[model samples]
Target: MMNYERLQSNINAYKKTGEILEAARFLIHQFNLDDENFAGFGFREELEKESILLTANGEIGEMQHVMIPKNIFDFDLTLVLNMLAHEMLHVRQKSPRMMILDKNEREWQAYYEMLFHTNFPQIPELSDYYKNFFGEKALIYYSRMGEGSELQLKYLEQKLEVEKFLQDIKNKTI
Candidate 1:
């Protein structure tokens, strides 16, 4: 069973930093990623950027541990969790040859699973591209990486379908 109370606590603890740290640890566990396989040892700097970034160096589909910036928890909790799912999935990539198919398929699967499997929580932001743009972004990223394949049609179709789905839900709620 999904633990809404626990998630709320992890994302909204008394100390914002503590909440984020808890959420990161919780998400790492949620995705079956190791808490210790990766490291976050840098001292907190007065970074002016909106947030920190993570880089995972490897061939496509190869699995890797990702470093999470502690600063990410400063964003909207739901948004940060969605971002966490996307960036961590980036830590595991497919080869360049299958980049188009693999990235889209994996991201779509991961996003739907993470969001819906959690029962859509009560966070409104979870319903939008802020949380559901994995497949869409995959299309943009991979198409730019290559000469742009015939799959552009399918990618566009998928993106349209998801957007329409979101819009339909919004309409029904209204």
Candidate 2:
């Protein structure tokens, strides 16, 4: 059973955290994103010491769990908002199919979306962390993308265009 009150409180907290995510979704919808693209995305916020989780196979917004340090509530709201957007993107793209793709692609899309929609900078440590954890390939790709290299941006743009095209086709068929 779900706790409706708790869920409502989290939604309210998220609104307080930042409304940019809402705005981003509005923009996506305004552009006519296929419904299947976000069929399983949802958000949740709870008082936690330090932890964030994303289920790559769940419905968008279906996973009702995100725990941030209680101290986060007092820190920069932008940071919280950025994290929320990042996690939400994870939820939006969750699927067994996504799991089969390069993990770096997943991270790249989330970070790219967050950076594109919000004021978050591409932190050096984050790039370094990915490099350390995933190796040179991820590092090179992430750095190129983060630096706004035309080639990398073009790749991302092309990928998004393809996704939109496929989605449009799906919508028409449905």
TM-score of each: 0.51, 0.36
**Reference-based lDDT, each prediction:** 0.49, 0.44
The number of the candidate with the highest lDDT is 1
Least accurate 10 contiguous residues by lDDT in model 2: 123-132
Per-residue lDDT of candidate 2, residues 1-174 (tens digit):
124355335545655767534533442343333234344333445445554333334443344233333344443333444555555556545543344244455566665554344322332123323223323333344555545665456466644543454455456656
In candidate 1, stretches whose alpha carbon ends up further than 4 angstroms from where it belongs are 11-23, 31-63, 95-148, 154-156, 163-174
Candidate 1, residue 158: the lDDT equals: 53
lDDT of 2: 0.44
